[model samples]
Target chain A: MKIFLHRRGFIARIAALMVLPFVAQRRAFAQSEAVDSLIEKITGGAPLQRGRVKLEIPTLADNGNSVSLRVVVDSPMTPSNHVKSIHLIAPKNPRPGVASFFYGAGAGRPQISTRIRLSGSQGVIAVAVSACWDAS
Target chain B: MAARISVPQNARRGDSIEIRVAIQHPMETGYRTDDNGTSIPKNVINKLACRYNGVEVFRAEMGSGISANPYLSFFIIAANSGELRFDWVDDAGVTGSERTSIIVAG
Candidate 1:
């Protein structure tokens, strides 16, 4: 009985050791689907590339009340190729949503500069989606 | 709600112009305590948008992290001469909008 119990304990320890890092990695990825789904609401669940979206914010912020933020997306402003919208998400804030920007063909470029509030230190996410539309 | 807006009154057609919008609000985060030690309710502009020539140009979904009296700057091509409209809404459902005219030099 003692040997069987000891083996069971050993097996459980090995199992925990194997799974801990993956759990740790998930925690480290800043995975906040809660805010991502908000973007999904606007995109209608279309596929999106995690590229072409740029966000500029201070690496270190002194105040949780307000922080300067800038976001940009690469796109041609032609009626056939244009950015549909841009959004900012702050996962740790009391309100995770920071901002959203919708761009038309007339928006020569997809970029914006603004100040936002942050309740604490967290990863900020920027996402942009584009679609073609007729000028008429 | 009154807002201050800036845009190039005159721009060559096809030229890109910058639009600036500044709105007035307290953007209360509801985290701070008043003189009576009661927690203030969170109130901030949750959404913002800019429309050019009656078409949507840019829109933003904001949170309490947004500063009081938010200021936003963005770009738009001078496609046709028309007015640019900026509008926003707070948590309390109060809405505000402002308009500025732009002359596209043909």
Candidate 2:
């Protein structure tokens, strides 16, 4: 912030620098919480806890057209303990639910990589569900 | 359809290796029309999946936002010698696949 202020001491620069964080903060919060609700809706309102899901994406992407992504879930992949499905959510995109990948014990490891389109810069969320946990 | 792939020929057990795949296609968007003034029906690869030794390891779903001649890069943990297969389906209901093999050293 100091560097930004020092580089551009103009009034517009000052205003922009100040407004940027607020805007980013609001958007970030809305986008993330929206993604959380989307996951909950997909899972039928099950308890949504965050852990064991890894989503890899570029921090800054100029072109929202085609962005590469990778997601991995830490699971044992055994019948008694395994990941049944992994879903991706991009809250701000035209389609919130970008992709859904199904897996079973045969999948060995629950991981996937693919390309996605983002209308603008926003964070992505991935949720992996456990069959054992769901079965009770 | 022509597809090209690049994967590690051999890797030490538990090594995370890179895999790249590129497919050739027009990927026409419905928004564009031909010289005849008829809208060029959209035909894009909507789904792509990667399977290792008959087990699905990766999957992706693309939309019209994707560029033509789609190329994707992914990773996998090499546990043993097996075949890595890729299958894709376009909106036009066309399906294609490509296969490659990798050997892991224990």
Candidate 3:
């Protein structure tokens, strides 16, 4: 009886130790998925490139409440290949989709500078769609 | 609800426009604990859209990764005189919008 009890206690401890990290990892994975969903939704299933949009943010933000941000897209401000719009999105904020901007071909430049609040250190995304001059 | 956005009343054509917007809300993410250790319910803005003279130019969907009092900046080509509109929506079904007009130079 004594031996059985000892073995049972040992097994229980080992099982718990094995399960803890998995639980923690699962939580982290869930958070990642939540953010991914936000991005997918914003793109409306469109493909996004890593270097296409330039997102300028501080490496470490002093205040999570307000941080400065600038997003610039590589596009000519011409009627043929201008940027139609720009969007800034954060998946973990109280509001996931932060802001959107619409521009026309007549708008000469394609750059924006603004400040944003971040709940924490989270990924920021900028989406730009090229103007369809033929349609216009 | 209405969103508060501020931009220069006058901007020259072909000049880069600066836009400042301040959204009023708690921006609760539901993951944090209060002083009492209770979980806070998630409340976040999920969608944002902007328009120039009624044409859809830019759109974004957001999550809880943003902080309170969210601010955004972007540019628009100043070709013709028209209104710039900003709109955003949260996860809990709250929506807000603000608008400003720009006088373009000939």
- Candidate with top TM-score is 1
Report the error of model 3 at residue B52, Å: 2.4
Residue-by-residue lDDT tens digits, candidate 2, B30-75: 6666777877777888898889898887776766545568776656
Question: For chain B alone, what TM-score does every candidate structure achieve against the true structure?
Answer: 0.94, 0.96, 0.83
- State the lDDT of candidate 3 residue by residue for B19-76, as single tens digits: 6666777666567677888877778776677777987655554445455656555555
Task: At residue B2, give the lDDT of candidate 2.
Answer: 92
Interface RMSD values, listed in order for every candidate: 11.7, 8.5, 11.1
**TM-scores for candidates 1 onward, in order:** 0.77, 0.64, 0.60
Candidate 2's residue-wise lDDT over A1-136, tens digit each? 1111122111110000001111123222233566656665656645454556777777765455556767777766667777767776666665567666665334546666766656555557676766664332
TM-score (0 to 1) for chain B of model 1: 0.94
TM-score for chain A as predicted in candidate 3: 0.65
CA lDDT of B49 in candidate 2? 88
Off by over 4 Å in 2: A1-41, A74-79, A104-111, A132-136, B12-18, B26-38, B55-57, B65-68, B73-80, B104-106
Candidate 1 structure quality by residue, lDDT tens digits, A24-92: 222222246876566556556554445566777877766545578787766666677677777777765
TM-score of candidate 3 chain B vs. the reference: 0.83
Cα lDDT, model 3, residue A118: 59
Each model's DockQ score: 0.39, 0.25, 0.33
Candidate 1 residue runs with Cα over 4 Å from true position: A1-30, A39-43, A132-136
